[model samples]
Target: MSGLFVPMTKANGLGNMPDLLEQWAGSRSVARAYGRAGLPMEVIQFPETWIPVDAIRSLFEISARAAGDRCFGLHVGKDMTHKTFGLWMKYSVQAATLRDGLIRANQSSRFQQTGGKVVFVPGAQVSFWRYVAPPMQTSSQVQHCDHLIWPTIRFIQSYLGPLWLPEWVDVSYPRDADARLLEAQVPFPVRFGTPYLSMAIRNRDLSPRTPRPFGDGQRITFDAVRASEAAGPSNETLGTVFNTITLRLLEGQTDIDGAACQLGIGVQKLQRDLRREGVDYRDLLNRAKRVRAQELLSDTDMTVIDIALSLGYSDHGNFSRAFRKMTGVAPSGFRARKDQMQ
Candidate 1:
C-alpha cells in the first residue's frame, strides 16, 4: 500500500534465513560502495525497486561509471533486488497504454520476488494491486510500495504523456508521503479506508493500445556489457572469443579458430587481449567450462559426461579433475551442496 512490500515466496527465496541474510547484506554493501564512489546506486535501485537482481545487475552494468574494486558491484550486487523492492511505492504516472502497461507489469511478476501478485479490483472503476510476499520476521508485508509508486508514475508520465490518468488512489500501509496530499502526484480520488493498494482508472480504458517498437536503441552483447561494467573497454578480446566458443562448445562443437574468426579479429590479437586480461584463451575456455559445468550440475539434472562433452572436455575424468581443481569437490558433491542450500 503506502510502503515497500517484497515477496516472501519460493521464487523470492522461499523465505529462507540464509537467502535473506545474503540479500540484505548484499544490498547495503553495494549501496555503500556507490555512495563512497559518488555514484548513485539508489537512483536505479529506488526507481525500479520491484525488479529482479539479474535485471538490476544489468542496469548497473549500463549506468555506473565507477572504477577499481567498486566496479565489482556488478558482480557483488547481482541479487540484492529483493531487499530494495521491499521499499518500492509503485508510482505509475503518465503510463503509456495505461491498462496494458499495468497488465503487462502484472504478467511480468516472474521478474519479481516470488509470491509476487498483481490484482485488479473493479468496483465502479478499476484498480491495480501488488501483493508481494510478507517479511519473515513479521506478520505483515513491508509497506514501502510508494518508493516505487513515485518513480513508476514519473517514468510513465515521461514515456506515455497524454495517455494515462489515475482516479483517487490509496493504500493501507504506512508511507512517507503525507496522507492529506497523496494525490498531488497521483491526483486521484482517494478512499484511504480501503484494504489494498489500488489504482482507480476508467473501466472503458482497461485495454489500451500497445507501445510501438518493443526494442530500445542500444544493443550491447553480454561480453561487452561485462567488460564495460568492469570500468574498462574491450581489453579482453579473448574473453569475447571465449564467450563465443563456450556457446559453440556448449552445443557440442569444437572450432576454437572459428570463434576467433567470427569475432573478425586475428588469432594473435585475440590471444594478446586475453593475455592482457590476466588469462590465456585456454584458461578462459577452462574457466567457462568449469563455470557452466558447475551451474548445470547444481541447477539441473544433467549427467557429468554430457556436461563434459558440452564444455568440449575430452573426457569425463578430465572434466571431473578440472572441476575439482576449481571447486575442491566432484560435480555430484557440488550439486548436492547446492541442493542443500535450497
Candidate 2:
C-alpha cells in the first residue's frame, strides 16, 4: 500500500507552509545515498519527513552514510537492508498507542538515514527535542523539512488531543523560531534557544508504552515483521474520514442535504460509515469544531458569534448551545477561562 505524505510542493496549507523545506536539501543527499545502496531513483521525496516513526528508518540509513566525508556532497553512509528484504517503508506513527513508542522511534530515528539526532529537552515538562543536521544539497528536496516538524505538532494533537496532549509546545532554534511559529501557529508557547530546536510537551506524556525493539533477526525475518507493521489497521480510514468531513464542512454547508451533496455521497452512507466507526457525523463535526474553537479562542480575539459563524453554525445562539454542549462551559465562559490561562 502506498503511504500519503504532505508533499512540500502542495500540502494546501494544512498547518505550516512548505517554506522551511527550501532550506534543507536533505532530500537530495538521501536520494544519492539511496542510489549508492543500489536503488535507482528517478525521484526521492524527502528531507520532508512525516511524524517520526519506524517508517523513517531508511532516512537513518542515509544519515549514517553522510556523518562526515571528504566532501559535504559525498555520501558517508547508506543502508540497503530494506531494499534487500524487498520492503518499502510507508507507516503511520499516529496508530501507536503510546507517546513513548513514538518518541523512541523519533530518537532512534535513522529510519531512513543516520543524519541527525532528536534529543529530549531537559526539565521542559513536555516531549521537547533538539534536531540538527548539515543542509542537504539538492533542489528536488525543496521544502521537505516542513513535513517532519509541522506534521509532528499536528500529529500529537491529532493522535492525542488536549486531554492527553501537551498543554504547550516550544521549539528551540532561533532561525526556526519564526517558521516554527508559523508551523505551530504557536498553539501554546513555542520558543527558540541558542543551540537547540525543541518543543515542550506535557510531563505525563513522555512515559507511555515502552518502545519495543525495531525487529532485527535475520534481515529476511525482520522484513516480514516490518511489512506486517506497515500494513493498514484494517483500512481504518480515520484521517480520510476526518479530512472528508472537514472538506465538506468547509464548502459552506447550508443544511444536511447540502452537505451530503457536497460530499457526493448519500446521507445514509455517511451515517452508516460513521456508525461503523462508533461515531455519528454530528459527533465528528462537534469534535472537529471543538478543536477549532479552542485554537481560535487561544489565538484570536474574535467574538463568539464570529467564531460560531466561521464554524458553520446557523447563528450565535445555536453556536453557543452547541459549544456549551460540546464543552461544559458556555462560549463566553470558555473564552474567559482560556483568556485567564493566558
**Can you write out model 1's per-residue Cα lDDT over 150-222, one digit (the tens) per residue?**
3334333433444454565565455434444444434456555444555555676655553553234333333
Off by over 4 Å in 1: 1-101, 122-124, 127-143, 151-163, 174-178, 181-186, 215-342
TM-score (C-alpha, index-matched) for candidate 1: 0.36
Per-model clash counts, in order, read 33, 35
Listing every candidate in turn, what is its Cα RMSD in Å to the true structure after a full C-alpha superposition? 19.3, 18.8
How far in Å is the alpha carbon of 58 misplaced in model 2? Answer: 23
Q: Model 2 TM-score?
A: 0.36
Query: lDDT of candidate 1 vs native?
Result: 0.45
What's the lDDT for residue 327 in model 2?
Answer: 83
Indicate the worst ten consecutive residues by lDDT in candidate 2: 71-80
